[model samples]
Target chain A: MPVMDKLKAVSGTAAIVGVAESDQIGRTPDKGPLELHAEAGRNALADAGIDKSEVDGVFTAGYSTYDVAEYLGITPHFTDSTSVGGSSFVIHIAHAIAAIQAGYCEVALITHGQTGRSDRARAGGNPGLPSAQYEVPYGIIGPPVAYSLAANRYMHQYGEDRTREAMANIAVSTRKWANMNEKAFFYDTPMSFDEYHDSRWISWPFHLPDCCLVTDAGAAIVITSAERAKSTRKGAVSILGAAEGHDHGILHQMPDLTRTWGRHSGPQALEMAGVTHDDLDLAMIYDSFTYTVLATLESLGFCGPGDGPDFVADQRTAPGGDFPLNTSGGGLSYTHPGMYGIFTVVEAVRQLRGETGQRQLDDCKLAMAHGTGGLLSSTGTVILGRD
Target chain B: MADGYNKPIPIPQPESDNYWEGTKAGELRLRHCDDCNQAYFYPRNICPECGNNNTSWIVASGNAKIHTFAIVHRPPHPGFMDDIPYVPAIVELEEGPKMATQIVNVEADPSKISIDMAVKVVFESITDEISLPKFEPA
Candidate 1:
């Protein structure tokens, strides 16, 4: 059988049955991360018309004091607390597929929440492993700095004169998409390419407008087999293909700072799903930084590596353009609660289901959702469709 | 002794002891797996490729080429504010492992740093307990 045929055999085998969120998310002084997660989880289950008792698995990313089984008041047959930075949610989807295919669990709930806006100013050392102590002391901190290194290198490798202007175009295009998304944090804040160029530099190549928002919010989704999804309250979004690849953990370990696992993983996912770039109607790429989205587009065969700047030029990524990207404003304009990967899956499913309201595409039958973790350490790509 | 300053230090573990010890001796050491013959840094007990536990610490030549880097104009943390517009780089070491280290002794001008500039290792003592390994133009 051909790859597409093989993929079609597994098509509709697993589906995301429901999705939900806890209110309009942002600087939520009234709530904590756990409360948002729990509320979103409850809402997802309610949307699926299923009770917590039926959930056999719970998957989450990052630190959490509330045990998945304990919070839901049921002992799950399987549990995964895999945290791979912002891309954890995308990885969670692949994990859910494995669990269902292995007969380990039937229904899995994946959720994310954070109080990033209020927590931004608070500074203390991250309490995990001290292996990075040597580098941390010299001031290599956070994703922005790490990604900035890659962005700077790309500019140097490929001429620098118009690079910032090219990047500004990308930010402007995303903002245009956000204007249609009422849920986005910067819905009313439309930005121009010139405005993006004039924005103060956060890290040389990366301007203030190029970075993603640090907003407080929570989102959850329910995944189960196609057989079970048929009985759910919401329509199903099929899992076409999913793949994850890791090159290195630390920024320095990357073979080439300008390139990432997305270059390798994105193509593999498309090949695995038996789909080509031409078949994709829309894309929800993880935009922790504008470079990430640009890199993914190039890696996924949308354009060549250095050609990303040209590919997204002239409002190409905006709605009514050749390729519609991040119709939900992406993390750049949307709420990013640290793990913004989950929202990519959520948004992709929404688009595939034609639930994006004004931001919805006219014919979004097939969609691609890409997520990155660590400092471009790991990448996960999932292709979703409605067949 | 001052606000927003804590003496940063590395706490060594079984997998990374040699790397820390190598720094004290002014040598950069990486772990080479006997099974796969692939050298790696950020010391792992087992080879990431072949999953072999038999590994040995080997001193590197400290020679490298700039693979990619970023010049940070903004400091995300208070500790880094003074070092704005500094270059944070990823260098491909001659020893066959890629390492993340600061590139020093080079003009901050973007025109100067190319994609594959040759570089060598230098050590900077940050605290009494730790000495960081950084790269400079070779």
Candidate 2:
């Protein structure tokens, strides 16, 4: 058997039994980060019909795993606090599968909550940290500044005018989805190409609308062995495959400005799942910035390099298009509370479960959720399916 | 760009002390691995290419090309507010490693700057202890 066949054994062994967000997303000044975690955890447990006491494995990012366990009132036999930026939660699902297979824990809960908007909290680093000393000193902090470097490079490699058009299309199309999603921050407001082009430049190559919203939100996921999932109230979405990787921590060190490790991880995930891009009914690629989606789509082999702008040119990824992407409005128009990875999974699970009210894709069976974190540094790709 | 030195100063680590020292002395230094026959930036003891501990410093030729960059209209640190619309970029050194630095001595405009444009190192003495390595069009 080939190496790819080895992953097939573990495929579909674990399933997501529950997925939920906090009571309120966007902005909630009353809720701290931990409280949002607990609210989402409570809702997810209720969704799974699993008692909080049943969760024996705890996985989270952006905070201490011990704190999450203490707040959730669970004593776990397994815990992983992998903090690879926004992609941590999606990576957690991959970790939960291995832990469950090892008999380390049967029930696992992965959670994320951040007060990015309410607290205005920025990810801190020690004074001696390389990023602080080198990258930050040059004013290359935050998503807009860091991500724009690559966006600029992408425009340089591709055509600048067409690339700008492609980016504007993402903002316009994604907002169209948000218009139908009452929970989306921009649900009431629609964006046009002229509006996106006219938005103020947060950084060159990135307009205000091109950046993700800084919202306060929380999301959670519960995973278990596929056998155990049979008894759950809501049918489980099988974790068909997952892969996580990073090429560099800082934006400058990235081998290619226009490409990411998504090139490697996306193929590995699809191969492990025994599925192809054609098999996916929905794609939940992280839209931290409009350029992120374009780069990721090309890296995932959905389109050829420098062809991203053309691929997304006419709002093809929007609702009522041939390829539906970011059906939950994505971080661009939806709520982005720091890490948007978990929400991608949440939205994918909802679409697979036929729970999305209006923006849902009909007959959505196979979905791929790709998460990009840091300065386009980390990536996690998870392929999911439902019977 | 600003009168006061309000921006952050690079805190030298044991691994990167020599690099900073070289910058202050008006020399851009890189870590060279004899085994791998390659040089890398943000100087550290271990060679990133081959994981070789037997490494030495070599002064860069001060020639590079713009790999990518962003004109930071919004300052991340309030200290950088005065330099609004400044260019922060990753320039690929002639020595083969990329480093984070500011593109100075040029207008911060799309028409003025581009990827693969030649640039050379220039030092800015921000404090008594540190001199930041900035780049300008060659």
Candidate 3:
């Protein structure tokens, strides 16, 4: 029983003392993917008031961990390059904590960046691998088509006005947050439900507004022992708990697209933290698509299988709403540079640390960051707390 | 968009040769696990369900229902420029394996496609070594 208690008490094992992003997010056409990683890493280390040499654990999904190490000139004793798509960095946080607890490394750095818009370095969709022989020939290539299949099915089983229209609420609500964020790509541009439905279709059931923005940006977070983090100049957010799991590598191969691994990972993550949904102050769910958020939210038990539409209706996730979701505008209106997962961590850390200027949640104590990767194929949830 | 249809062709791997050959012969086949009797797609020597190497192949009914579908206005690549506004779908074969395919012989409008709509497979020979199994209204 004592051993079980010890294992469960991972809340304060490690703390994120620093969170930073590359400068000039929306249109950094000059910088490449690696340059963005280097800048974000350097800036994050500076935020922690720590030196690059202090980083012994490196975690990244944007580029090879070895390349990240070389670019930052920090040779990490432990490295992770798990590329489950956008959710890799959030899932990597769980692994970073485990490695830190196990004494593999002290300070872990998780970084992500890409020139998804300007340079055509789009992330997530891996082409010409194994699935290519089967899926590619029929044009099951990218997320737009791959994920739209599931959305269309959900609309069919339920109803389009309920399911698909509910998805539009996410886009509109996300834009509402973007309007408040000076850094958001759509900061000046507001979205309306009518405009959302009228937008050109990339794939049926998913309009232009429903798709995530492709920008050039990078975000990173630095974590170390909770005790060590207390000495840093920045406020440290405790790593309460985190869990990661996957349903399928390829979207079509997923046995059930209606739900993701979030069903398992979300509960397991909250249980590890000894927290409940009621304890959460904010949620930063990956919004690669409106359906991505809905599918994950339902599976996380926030709503029933067919309840996503009503749950998000009336702009519940928008500003001045009960559920403060995607306070960073999410991928919908925020800068989604390939893998958007790391940015969610950055925003959650800021919200918990009370650093968010305008979109700050009052008396924020606990924040949830859920990352969905590979077209609802993989899910990772990390519960951060201000202890 | 290019004048020539330059869509990339699939080079058959050793394990998937049988499936490709079956498509060329105008027949749809899938691997069935002798241990678990689970039918799976994308032609592999080993059964994905039971991990049985001693799997047998069976000719599929080639009949499936539209599990889900999407009308892609933008092609993943420029090679598919000619095939814009196409409906790509995940169809569940009668044998229980889900295969990624395209729904053809239907109106171009997105509203025309519906889930669980009965469809059957048709072979399209892209090249000498490659043949694709497409689906259309039954």
* Cα lDDT of model 3 by residue, A168-262, tens digit: 88999999999989999999998888898889989887888878998999888999999899899786799887888887877678878788889
- C-alpha positional error of residue A184 in candidate 2 after TM-score superposition, expressed in Å: 0.5
Per-residue lDDT of A182-248 in model 2, one digit per residue for the tens?
Answer: 9999999999889989889889989999899999999999999999999998978999999998999
Write the residue-wise lDDT of candidate 2 on B1-138 in tens digits. Answer: 335788776788888888888888999989999899889877788988888789888999999999998888878778889899899999999989999899999999988998899999999888877889999999
**Candidate achieving the largest lDDT:** 2
Compared with the true structure, what per-residue lDDT tens digits does model 1 show for residues B91-130?
8899777777788998866778876899999987665555
User: What's model 2's lDDT at B75?
Assistant: 81
- What does DockQ give for each predicted structure? 0.53, 0.81, 0.69
Ten contiguous residues with the weakest lDDT in model 3 chain A: A121-130
Computed on C-alpha atoms, the DockQ of candidate 1 is 0.53
Model 1 docking grade: medium
Residue-level error in angstroms, candidate 3, position A155: 0.8
- Which is the better candidate, 2 or 3, if ranked by TM-score? 2
Q: What is the lDDT of residue B91 in candidate 2?
A: 94
iRMS per model in Å? 2.6, 1.1, 1.8
Residue A161: error of model 2 in Å? 1.0
Per-candidate TM-scores read: 0.89, 0.98, 0.96
TM-score of chain A of each: 0.94, 0.98, 0.96
Model 1 misplacement above 4 A: A1-8, A63-66, A121-134, A161-163, B1-7, B30-40, B44-61, B94-96
Ten contiguous residues with the weakest lDDT in model 1 chain B: B1-10
**Arranged by lDDT, best first:** 2, 3, 1
